[model samples]
Structure formats: structure tokens, C-alpha cells
Target: MAWNEPGNNDKDPWKKKDDKNQGPPDLDDLLKDIGNKFGGIFGGKSSKGGSKKGASNVGIAIALIVGILVYAFSGFYTIKEAEKGIVLRFGQYDGTVEPGLRWKWTFAERIIPVDMQTTRDLPASGFMLTKDENVVRVEMQIQYRVVDARDYIFSVTNADDSLSQSLDSALRFVIGDSRMDDILTSGREKVRQDVWKELDDIIAPYNLGLIVVDVNFKDARPPEEVKDAFDDAISAQEDEVRFLREAEAYARGIEPRARGRVKRMEQEAIAYKQQTVLDAEGEVAKFNKLLPEYLAAPEVTRQRMYLSTMESVYANTSKVMVDVEGGNNMMYLPLDKMMQNQSSGQRTLPESQSRANQSINTQSTAPDLSGRADRFNEGRN
Candidate 1:
């Protein structure tokens, strides 16, 4: 038989091996499979065991690389300026970490970034009794900054939400104890400050390291249905105060002037009285000074004063008259003609002056010379 025939014992070209004659695996071929297992055990690159070992090693290397990368990523973290990073090791707080790039243990640690510079707002969420015993709805906003990161993260479960709820409770407590009228008007500012204080007190007991900022009143008013009435009442009160102030201002302006006018009138009255008294005193003094002079020479002064008064009375008149019982009566008593006759020496003198000039003793009117003028008239006729 030829060697290439069915009796040929040479290795097949596809085998590519020198002491190996296995094809693959066969079902129900127990000895063949068992013999092939021994060959593959000793086989090099073409063997299945070597391929499996290499594949497993390659897969293990890929897993190791992936694990190392994860570890590096766990160590890397960024902390912004406004943020604080809190690390908890297996649910236990370690300490506080500030901003910037940082590296920490990766696997068993936890990180929470709390914003340190953010402003939080908390609203008043309940009915509060004001100083006036009214239930007023006052919404307050609180601004806060995170000061302690470790406390913020570990002190409370949810720090921001917890503080918000606590703020409402605190505000209600403060306002419920206050009267409504005071809250609406004067106590609002006090309520704000008190709310903040109470919030601090409530939070401090829990070791919730929170810095309370300002708490301010948002809207302070009565309930909606009574808002208008309150407004009207407030406006009426305002008008009353305004009118009172205006009246006070008017009084302040007029009082001084009124007082000044009264003072001026009083001064004028005093001056008038003083002048009247002075004039009366002057008249009395003058009368008192002249009384003695008039008393010293009563008849002479009276006669002289009477002559002066007659001259003054007759100065404007153009007539004069004199008559005696036993004396001659003139025919024409013209003032100009009598003066001319006296000057021309054609007038006769009266017996009174003739008796006084001749130094003769004259008989008085009481000596009964009754027929003298008749006898003289008859002799002249």
C-alpha cells in the first residue's frame, strides 16, 4: 500500500505539531477526549489552557486599571469659594475642609458641599397674635449664612430645611405672645429682632452651628376680609393726628403775637393813665401857686383885673356911657367929637374931677342934694 493511503501514519499538515495528533473534541469518544486533555495540558500557544490563562490575566489587568482610576477619582474633589466640603468617614464626621483643590481617602469617605455664602430665606408661616390681641398674618424673611460646615452637615439631618421649619415655629411663638396692635405699629421691629433671637436660641440647643442673620417682616396686616377696615381706621387716626398737629402749630404761631398785642395794649393803657394824672397834677399845682397871690391884695387886684377885663371887652366896641343924678347930661356923646372937644378946650370938666382938682370939700350923694340938678337946669334955661 502507498503511505498516503488509509494506512498512512504520517502527521496531517493542519496539525502543525510533532507529537500531537488531536483534532478537536468528540462526543461519546471518552478515551480520545481524555488523551486530548493531556496533550492540551502540556501544549504551548495553540493549547486551550494557555489561551484561557492569558485571557484571564488580560481581563484581570483591565479590572485593575479600572479600579485604580476609580480610586484616583475618589481622591479628587473641588471646593468653590462659596462652598465648604464636609467629609464623613463611614458615617462619622471627621473635620472641616476649606475651599480649593483637595485629595482625600476615596472609598469609605463621604462628601457634602454646603454653600457658605448663599443667602437663605425663611418665611413666617403661621397666624400670630399682635399686641392689640389681633391674629395677624405676618410673613418674615430671614437671611442666614453658613458658618460651620461640620455642624451644618452633621448637626441636623437637613440643615436648611430644618432651620426653615424651626424659623416658622420661632416666629409664631414670638408673635403669638405679642399683641396685634403693637405688631401692626410699634412692635414690628421688636418682633423681628425677637424672632431672630428665638431662632438662635432654638437652634443653639441642638448644636446646629448656624449663624442667624437678620429677620425682617415682609407683610404685616390683618386678615384679608378686614384689611380695608383696618386701613380706613389707620387713615382716620392719621388724619386726626395730622389735624391735631396743625392746630398745635397754629396755636404756637398765634399765641406769641396775641400775647404781644395784649402787652402792647396794657402798655398803652398805662401810658394814657400816667399822662392824664400828670395833666391834672399840673393844673392843681398852677392853681395852688396863684391862690396866694390873689389873696394878698384882694380888692386892688380885683379892681385892676376888672379894668383890664373891661379894656379888653371894649377894645372892639365904639361906644361908652356915664350918668350922675345931679350932674349935667351931655347932648351929643359922639366918641370922636368928644375927643376933639376935649383937645380944643371946648368941653367942661366933671364936678368930681373939678372938686378933686380945686381941693374943695364935695358933698356926698348921701347928703341930700336932690334939687341941685333941677335948680341948675332952671337957672340955665
Candidate 2:
């Protein structure tokens, strides 16, 4: 039967044989027995007085060892190459740490790592009034990096946020001082430069510990309400610039050719003038050389000059006239006309025989030809 069952008469299975009516041992006695067994295993005296004290000392030592391990492990940390750690002791600034493995008191110090080498971007965009009282939407991008870890962490409440506000303020200030046409077109670079300068000035006194690497004027445009009109205006402006450049190129190309033509004409005129002057000088020199000869023999020179002049005149003439000394008739020979007639299918005598025949006819017609020839010679002398 089961122990403590009605039929078993509440018999205790673990009781001694001499015990009677000692139903179930007392709770305090059982606890004491368990404690004595544990104390004996751990080298503690099983006597009631010394066992409690020995157990308490063992527990205190274990607690102390655990606390030491937790504190040691919690202090170790690592910093990245691009980061700088800001240490604070008892909520007050301590010092900074470089990148590497480092340790600090677990609950006494705190480290805040700031990324010093990372380039952060702050964008500012809004519709702003131009100097000409026009609204323009301008978008700008500011690239920056943290220069001082301590200043970045403590000098400002929020460095990035403060920088963003400064950027907006600077952009607006620059845009407000600029004309709309410049902002939308050729003045973008100037606007970008102005914004960068103004932003730096605004943050200089605040010591935000940020270095602005570059400022990009991302986009600038008129509002959507007049987008098409503005686009047309911009296109027209572009066309004007293109036309001006093309015209300048054309002028540059044509100027050289024009100058060359002018130079060539000037050279040609110089050559013509020199030739004329040289010819006149040669004529004067020849006349001077002939003056003495003419003075030495005036009549002979006069006759010779007259004959020479007549020879030169007749050499270029196609008609010839001969005056007989004592006859009233003059003979004419149209050689050029005769030659044209002959080529047009008319028969003509040989040139030499024709001249001979003309001479014979003239001699036969003239009377006293020798006396007339003597008279012409006497008249010339």
C-alpha cells in the first residue's frame, strides 16, 4: 500500500524503525540537514555555528570576481580610421582619442565618435526674390567635412543642422542681390561663388568646425507658371550669342583677306608710280645728251630730227601720200585697204612690182623732175 494512505495507517517510508507517531520530519530539521551536506562538500565545517559564516564568505568572493570581469570587458572599444572619439568623464569633457583599440572606465567615461574624414552634403533649395523683384527657384549643394572633433561635438548644438541653416541664409542673401537673368543664365558661377563666401562668413563666428569643400549651383529656373516664356527667352539669348560668335568668326576670317588685298593694291600702285617716274627721268637724260650735238650743227640736226619724226609717224600709218616736187597732183596708196580687198577674193599685183610701176608712172607724169629736185634741195638748204 501507499504511504500516508488510509489502509497503510499513515506510515512514514523514510522514518527509523524505533520512531512512533513521528509523522513526517520537521521542515527546519530537513533544511538544516541539506545545509550540512552542502557545507561538507565545499570544505566548510558542518557544525551549525561556522557553516553559515563560511558560506557567506564564499558567496561574497564569487560576486566580487563577477563584478571585476564585467567592468573589464565593458571598458574595451574600437575606433575606425575615419573617426575621432570624444571622451567625457563624469559628464564633463575629458580628452580625445585617436583611431585604434582603446579602453576607459566603464561607468566613469563616455566616448562619442565623430566622422572627421567623411564628406557630407547639405542641400538648400527654395524660391527666392531676385534683385529685379522676380521670383526664381534656386537649388544648391554644399559639400563639407568635419575639421575639429571637439569643436564639432561641443562647440555647437548641432553642427550639420546649423550649417544647413547657414547655407540657406547665404543662398538667399546672394540670390536676393542678383538679377533673375543672371541667376538663370550666365551669372550662375558668380552666384555660386557668392553663396560659398557668404556661408563661410556666416559660420565663421559660430565656430561650427566645418570646412566647405565645394558649393554646386545645381539648378536655377523661373516658376512653372512662366516656364515656356522663359524658355523662349533663354533660347533667343542663346541664339544671339551664337550669332555673335559666328559673326566674329566671319569677320576674323574676312579681315585678313581684305588686308591682303589692300596691301597688294598699294604695292601695285607703288610699282606703277616708280615706272612712270623712271621713264620721265630717262627721257630727260637723253634730251640732255643730245643738246650739245644739236648746238654744234643746227640745220643738219633740224633736218635729221624732222625726217626722224616723219619716219616714226609714217611707220604706224596704213595710208601713204607722196607729193611730186613740180606737179600739182599727190599720189595716195591705201595698202591696208588693198590687202583686205585682196583677201576677200580680188586679184592684186606683187607688192614690189606694184611699187615699181607706181614710181614709173609718177616719173612719166612729172615734167622737169631734175630741176624740181634741185629746187627742193635748194629750198631745204
Candidate 3:
């Protein structure tokens, strides 16, 4: 039977001892009963006043301990390997925390985790006026990372946004100072370097705590209306550079050969000079030796010299022509044809011509030209 049914009066679950009411007990009475039970467990007397006081004290202590444990546990957080945690106490800078599990005052402190190792890319692009007042679309990218957590958080309201604006300002300054042709072509690298330097200068005073690792010149081109013309100009510049390099290479190749030819000419000139000097010296020595002989026997020396000159002149003559003194007739000797026939080994000369050649060779080799002078004198006598 149910507790509320008849003959179940003594089995009422909500009924207390010495209670007359059948409904639930009063709130104050129920609380008093709970306090008495707790007080009894803690060795407090069952008197109403002592039980209530002991229970109240015990409950407050237990609640305070539980709150402390919860606060300590909740304060624990982890800093990753690449991050540095910035701790703030009462909305003011406190200290920094390294990677690992860390704890702080739960409600009195806060941590802002900043990634220190990751590289981030920020791009700046716009159509800007060049030094020549020409508008060109230029795009650049900078790789950066946070270096100081405190400065990154406290120095600026927004560090990343500040860096981005700095980039834009630096890029615009450099672009405005550069020519459009350079921005779109060969000067792109130089422009990129200038922008990097300018950006560093701009952000250094602000202390945004960001360091730029690299600056890249992504793209630069004339406006779409002038794209084709710029492309043509760029191609022409490339061709000009290529031709200049080719000309340099050609000059390099020809320079060595020209130098070699000049050296050879110098050597030949020196040899010719030396040979001329030696020949002149030899002629002077010959004249010095012959001076005494010429003084002693002038006629005989003159005749010998004349005969030697005639012999040397005749040695090179292949054909000789002699005119008869009294008749209108000339005699021609074809000595070149005779020599050619003898060399060919195909034709034999007549016996009379062979004897004549032998006699001519013998006379040409005779060594006593001075004796010939004496023979001429004897014939004269």
C-alpha cells in the first residue's frame, strides 16, 4: 500500500517523530534537523544553539576550500612551443611566461599568447604614381614575425595592422620616388630593397615588435590601358641587354686575337731591325778588310770586283740575249728550258749542248777571279 493510503499512517516517508502535521515539514525545521545531524557527526552537542553554530561554521569552511581549489585549477593554462605568453595583472603588464603549463591568479590576472616562431606574410598593393607621374600597379609582400610579446601587445593598439600600414606607407614613398619604367622592369629589386629599408625606419620608433624577415617584389606593371606598350618596352630593354652582353663577348674574343697580332708584328719588326743592323755591320766589316787591298792594287781589285758582280748577276739569269756588234741579229740562249727538260728526265739534250752546259758550269765555279784580272792584263800586253 501507498504511504498516503489507509493503515499506512505510521509508514509516512515525510513524517518525523513527535510530529502532528501530515504535510511536509517547515523550511526552518528541516534546516534545523540537517544541522543537528552534521553537528552530531562533528562531536557537537545536540542542543539547538550549539548544533546550528557548529554546522554553520563547518559549511562555510568547506565551501571556502572548494572555491580555492576550483580557482587554482582554472588558472592553469598551457603555452605552446612556438608561443610566448604575456601575463597581465589587474589590466597592467606583469611578466612573460614560457612554453609549458603555467598558473596565475584566476580573476586577477590574464594571459595573451603570442606566436613567436611562425612567419606571416603581409601584402601591399595599389596603383601609385611614379616619379615621372605615371600610374602603375605595384604589389609587394613582406615576411614578418613577432619578436617582443609585450611590445607587440602594449606598444600599439593593433601591431599587425600597424605593420601593414607601415608597409603601405613605405611602399608608396619608394614607388613615388621611383620611375615607372624601373618599377615595372629592372629596378624592381632595388625598389623592393628601398621599401624594406623605409619600412624598418618607419616602424622602428613605433616599436610594433615585428621584424621583417624578407621583402619580395611580387609584381609591377603599367595600368591595363598601357600594358601592351609596357610589355613592348620591356622586351626592347631585354633585347638591348642581350645585345650589349653579346657585344662584350665579341669584344672579349677579338681582343686577344688583336693583341696576339700586335705582338707578332712587334716581334717581326724587332727581327727586321736586328737583321738590318747585322747586315749593315757585316757590310762595314767587309769594306774595312777590303780597304787596304783596294789601296794597294786599285785596278786589279776593281777588275776582280767587276767580274764577281757579273758572275753573281749571271747566276740568276735563266735566259740570256746577246746582240751581234756588226749584224742586225741577236742570239738567245734558252737555259731555263734546258734545265726544265733535264729535271723532267724525259728528254735528252744533244751532245754539243751538254758539253756547252758543262763548260758554263765549270766557268761559273772557278775561284780565281784575281788571276782572271792578270790574264786580262797579259792579253792587253
**TM values, all candidates:** 0.55, 0.68, 0.69
Reference-based lDDT, each prediction: 0.69, 0.80, 0.82
Best-first order by lDDT: 3, 2, 1
**On a 0 to 100 scale, what is the lDDT of residue 26 in model 3?**
61
Writing each residue's lDDT as its tens digit, candidate 1 over 238-290 gives 78879999999999999999999999999999998997688668756744564
lDDT of each residue in 191-309, candidate 2, tens digit only? 99999999999999989888999999999999999999999999999999999999999999999999999999999999989976886687557555655555566556556666665
- Write candidate 3's Cα lDDT for 1-381 as tens digits: 677876538778778878867876666666567766766776755555554575585686578779989987999999999999999899999899999999889889999999999999999999999999999998899999999999999999999999999999999999999998888778988998999999999999999988999999988888999889889999999999999999999999999999999999999999989976886687567656765676568677777876876765565444445667868765566778877865664245466555555545544543354455456567978
Best by TM-score: 3
Candidate 2's C-alpha runs over 4 A off are 1-57, 296-381
Displacement of residue 166 (Cα, Å) in model 2 is 0.7
Deviation in Å, model 1, residue 247 alpha carbon: 2.9
* lDDT at position 314, candidate 1: 51
- Compared to the true structure, candidate 3 yields what TM-score? 0.69
Q: lDDT for model 1, please.
A: 0.69
